[model samples]
Target chain A: MSTVLLEEEMTDTPAAPARLLSAGPAAPGQEAAWEQFTKIPLPTRTDERWRFANVKDLDLSPYLQPQPVDETTREELLARSRGLEKAAGRMVFANDQLLSREVLSESLTRLGVVWLPLEQALVEYPDLLQQYFMREEAILGGQKFAALHASQVRTGMLLFVPRGIEIDLPVEAFHWLHGANSSCFPHTLIIAEERAKVTVVDYYESADTNAPGLACAVNDLWLGAGAQVTYVCAQNWSREALAFQINATVVGRDAQARSLFAQLGGRHVRSESVSHLRGPGGRSDMLALTVADNAQEVDARTFQIHEAPNTSSDLLYKNSLDDAARTIFSGLIRVDPGAQMTDAYQKVRNLLLSDDAEANSAPGLEIEADNVRCTHGATSGQIEQEELFYLMSRGISKRAAQKLIVNGFLQEVIERLDQPEIGARLAEMVQAKFAAHR
Target chain B: MSSLKIQDLHVRIGEKEIIRGLTLEIPKGEVHAIMGPNGSGKSTLSKAIGGHPDYTITSGDVLLDGVSILGMEPDERARQGLFLAFQYPMEIPGVSNANFLRAALNSRQSEGEEIEAVDFYEHLYEEMDKLEMRREFTSRAVNEGFSGGEKKRNEILQMAMLKPKYAILDETDSGLDIDALKIVSAGVNAQRGPNIGCLVITHYQRLLDYIVPDVVHVMVDGRIVRNGPKELALELEEKGYDFIKDALAEPVSA
Candidate 1:
């Protein structure tokens, strides 16, 4: 748990051109941020926020900045980048580089909806980009990785829905890690003005099987008064890669935000999600589903901060672990002073599929306000013997029965999404993951 | 030509013996009923034949077309043309009834063979119509939050869909009212043909009137003491089970 300097980690990473520091055209003071990124110390076992994490796996010395993918590989990824049948727009990224962009319906552009890649958004809407980009500090033990993402991120998407504008179809972004021993940082920013409604989906994948890669991702979401937003993150990296994801959500007066994170891949994954209720009558729903197997580890840390009165937040996280896999869920709800009538609930459920698999759950609540309702709980269980027997009696094999029950267990989270297209897509991805691993 | 035969079966649950020295035969094209008093091992006999893990066959052979099914797993036995209509059907959450039935049907087909979606739906609707099940049941989770009568009807719906060579209906008439019993019985009767055999296990003679069993067997103390033509069911209803008890207590003179 000794302190390790970032300079030591960077000694193995070769220097890149100055243009690489700035993610896009008008991201102001990128050089200063890169300088600050190098001074932040790497997370160690001694950090309380990373208690159950496999700290040794966080070593970044062996990884280097990813090179641009070849044209053939780019074409292949673009061909395979399929999602919902109907999307408002789609952007695909490989190794922190934009591969392809598809815009839907010229009518949407005429409606004043700004859907562009980060580089383009930086150049065209510099003021908006500078206002909301990474404004929230990292507070969930990913400070070092957050800084790394800010320093190296070059490709992502920016979605802005103007006031009173509602889009029927979801916008999607796909990020793929392409080669062995390569690393990429993908960032996404979404802003919904007053009374605007939208849904955004982000998918993470690896281009090849068994490729060792590093994926550091950051997402910033802002919801104005009465705005409703749904964000879904489908993270399905290869089994040999390391992944770090940091998500921060800000909900304004009377605004409602719902975010669902589906984690299905990566050898070692650490996800930190923070939801801030910044105004009265704001509600945020945080949900996550993780399927970890084959010695993989998934560590999730979440925070729900109720900073205003009459705010409510509900968080549900479910994990299914098999083989020698491990999962850690640590979540806390804090109701600050003057945040009266605040309601918060945090629950973590784990399903262990093997005797050797391990699941650690820690749920806590901090209430400094009166007339507040806060509850938190964690539960770990295996497939019910009777449920398995019932399925097997219906002629399903043991393996298939376990798969069905696991899917059924995780289906609740997807059903909570209440978005059919995205739910169906997430279900397909989860089923595909199960099929491949089994 | 197909028959389900139980030969000198002795079954146990954990360390306690349940079905002792029992034997029966049910052949295709015939509906046989087994009526027994409470604690007579009628349900145990059905579970033992269906390969329930809780019941162990210390000495017995359950043969489907003359092959012993004791060595097979429950699903293997099910896929090998054996079905057990449970008295209390399981409620599987989040698994649609259509999907559950499809999985069962798919298990019978060879690998890489896909079930036609349209044909499957058509067939399912037809069976549901016979049972008077609402079309919404297909999309609902299997037996989840279903009423008592609805759960029993779902069991019958499954029996109709699977079309196993041999089916053991263990108390399928337990929780149904008179109306539901008639509907369920009609559903069972419709599936009766030269290709399928049925063994109806019940505690009361009430179910026998609806299904019209060709043979009635009175089981006592884990064994069938008397079996006769369909008229025996009517006689048992009139004379009560005391007739068999008195007869068994008296020695059989050579």
Candidate 2:
């Protein structure tokens, strides 16, 4: 591959920001979103929504819009954007620019399943895209970032599965940040109609793991009556990047939604996930795994609201922190008065590998409903000396032993996904990170 | 020189010394049973040999083959062909038995060399069958939710897979019934050959009946007072430990 200057590409067009902004309101309500973003204040130390956060590090001033990639670089990134071995479909994007797309198989397309880039979906199915497009603002302290995402978001995924259609194979999307101090907004919006089921895996990555950049992402999953959806986001931006991922999931009558965030990269990552259990027998499983090391800080906030009777939600978030890394987990379970017979469980576990590493967990519950069952807890601990020595005693080196123990520690959460192939892929990716650390 | 040798080994936990001036050697092709009363540091001896971090060997040296292994880490000592079967085996929650054993075997090889999965599973299943362990034990986490007999058998299963040069069984028959004791002893007996040295630590002669050691050492107050043939275990069982005290009171005799 030849190294070519992106400046030459820019001369043919304008800079990336001007080109993207001049396209004017990429999505509906985006113009108003940019206005709202200017009004929302940056996080402050006194702000309870920003508790235990390094408020100063939330600055977005250092970030600049990335320049368009040269053809050679785009091809290189597209070639490197590997995901699952047998994905039903895939879309790869770099610097908010679509690089490639593997359209769905004929059977899926014939079944009226619509899988397209968000921009293309707006043109082909304008009425369908408007219904679930950034339907609500971020409610858990990411309002400004969500608005910024809406304004700057150029391309992502729009997957719509018709009623009673269950796609056995998962669809994947890869969003890569390719330049230093540049920014990208990636979005994934899924709508599963009544009795329809689908699984989607999204990869948020960086071309250079050491480059400083900004990533603002939003993913919303809407499951209609009896629908089921499983969504996973593997966030592995550069080590010096500041990133935010806002997730909103709504489960209707008897529907189920499970979304997981595998947080492996970034300097400071703040993620907010909220689940709305909207109707009777609806259930939501919110899971997250964070493998944080060095000076990385991961701040995760979650809210599970049971808005209808017989609704349930389960949240499990596990973090393994090493070196001087830090993690914060704050979660709440709310049961409305009309949502009696609700069941909600929230658990957060942090495995601290270094003495300097820190973990903070606060779990809360609000119950205005009768006959509700809700339990929430957070625990932080280091690897058991006995367990480590036990593995080491069998001839595994200290690093290998810790890796094995940590892998086993995380097996519990991975098994809950019940997707063996996807779970194994996630485990392998995590092991690659561990190997890279060594 | 082809033996695991301990020379004047003194072990301590915190400020309190446990094993004082303990000297012993188990040459290849032989099994040495050390029968001691409580607080005699029999368990400490195995732990010190295994290079446990807590049991500090303050003054003496332990040798594997002819090389001093006192300076090595626990894993290095293990890679140097030393295996210790804990009296109370640890239960690792998420590590499958197959993976743990495979790691041990792989650790003994060159870096990045893993054993073939098919051959590993076949060999593991063969050995598990010999120990009467269920086939499902391979997928289950190492020793998690295992019974007393199953835990001991699991330890022996590890010994079978690792095939260490020196083997230490710290009360291998502690909580076993007669049937379990016989099965565990048979498992150990299968590994006894000219290429391996064994040390069996126990309090009762009942375990000795099944294992049938070639030599017996009586330890009291952190010191091995006498070394005798296999018949010594029966004698100790008949006369009880009090007789050893009386015998020690007598004047020195060859």
Candidate 3:
């Protein structure tokens, strides 16, 4: 319905071989990780971490491993990969195969910042890839999915910002699932050396609106001492697709890392994020916004670990649920025994727009140090009737009024991003998503 | 040529009737004031005319420009050029005052028709200057964390930008100080012209001093008991509301 065309359906074509992964020889850790992935049992409702989640949807037997996309389909996806107007660099991938790559500027390259596809980076900078690739496991209960991603993720971006250098513009990556009943494993690993600053945006989309697909993604962000990094993940799969996004962040001394996860599409999505403030004076800000409509379900889990003194972590997640949609948020913050002066906070707010919509939130905090400050809270409610009446009294239609209120509710998180261009782009995406429902 | 006519309007909250058989009319190019004591249904009358969901009109009708709006929703009534300046304006978080006013104006336009940014900002800045509102106020949330005076000024700002055919000021002077009262009165006075009519509701005669209504009506119970010219407001101020109460208590000659 939107002017942003994704792809057209092509029927009656014989299915291609699906088990041929494009990734090269896996490292020792990745090999063992894949073995464990095959051995680890699928999650059940009995698991505490997956409580209240629809675990029955985790069956991936019907979805074949990604197959090589046809040239025509690949060209169509490449043409449809529209995003930020200008970026430091951009990469487009479909079905876990690199379709296109735009190299960085000469100035950036001279400064020793390497922005390469994961496969290329594995061959060119093997030492860096081996040291940081999947180094921090998914501790928020997506270990099996993370292992699968490690084994199959051949298409993504590896951005390495060397010491004392800063990139003014953000780098971008687009991952598309092209075929029906296919799966894509997209990984983004970023390492910002001491005093470096960089930002990366990852966009996950489907080529067909009605096709059923699976997307398993992992983003590992490593910030060296005094480094700063901002990472944004915008997931917009097809309506029938299922998605799992696992993210891990490790902040070093005096480093600052901010990450925003925006969930706007998909039939069912489960996101897990973990931030570890491993050094003194390190700061981590975790923000997420979910707009769930229809019968879709979104479940989010997060962990903030304070392992050193003078560390701080703040987390805020907001969801707007409409129709019979459902959302679940479970987050925890823990401070180690010696991590004194640790400041941590977690808050989740769910706005229910329809009578049948539902939200479940569980927030927890564990503090062992004596001088730490930790707080966590969750709230679920409907839009204020008075506010609704106020807008309606001004001659705005009820639907438009609700849209404005929802935008206002989610705008706070976007404003916190402090990057106006990126914020505006996200808002437009929100608008497009809402338009699709209409 | 146009008028807001409320004919024998009886409004209620749940089962208890508030405005009992109130009838009034304010044609274009006139300012009418309704002065009453506490619980005299002055606010209820304005709300009923504005199609507030809380107060339902049990009988009679509210006609805007000769068209009965009894069955219309609040937004529909609003789009028909009926504006209510609330006594306690609601605060909408994260919705900028500029955007709120723009939406109000935009709702009056035809489909796919957008207000030009150049003209909108020019007109908005002109009105803000008249209301003594700061430039930054436009970007702030609608009346959120605003003082009582600021909120009233914002309501006036909306009225100016919306340019409604008929405006209802329901107790707009209740929380305003003397200075704020003067500023708000100036804003209303600036908007006074042959194209607009107004109904100002107040508890005290003090507001009538600044706005200087052309006609003043006194309501004691649920009905307007007396109607007169501007001099009546001065008389009420000198004698207090007790004069009306005493006058009503006297037995009528059959």
User: Each model's DockQ?
Assistant: 0.61, 0.74, 0.71
Give the CA lDDT, 0 to 100, for residue B212 in model 3. Answer: 85
Q: Interface RMSD values for the candidates, listed in order?
A: 1.3, 0.9, 1.0
The C-alpha TM-scores of every prediction are 0.93, 0.95, 0.94
Q: How far is B161's C-alpha from truth in model 3 (Å)? A: 1.1
Show where candidate 2 strays beyond 4 Å.
A1-29, B249-254
- Ranked by TM-score, top first: 2, 3, 1
- What is every candidate's alpha-carbon RMSD to the true fold? 5.4, 3.3, 4.2
True contacts kept of 1: 0.42
State in Å the error of residue A432, model 2.
1.3
Ranking by DockQ: 2, 3, 1
Best by lDDT: 2
Residue A138, candidate 3: alpha-carbon lDDT: 84
Docking class of 2: medium
Off by over 4 Å in 3: A1-15, A19-30, B249-254
What is the alpha-carbon lDDT of model 3 when measured against the actual structure? 0.87
User: Which one wins on DockQ?
Assistant: 2
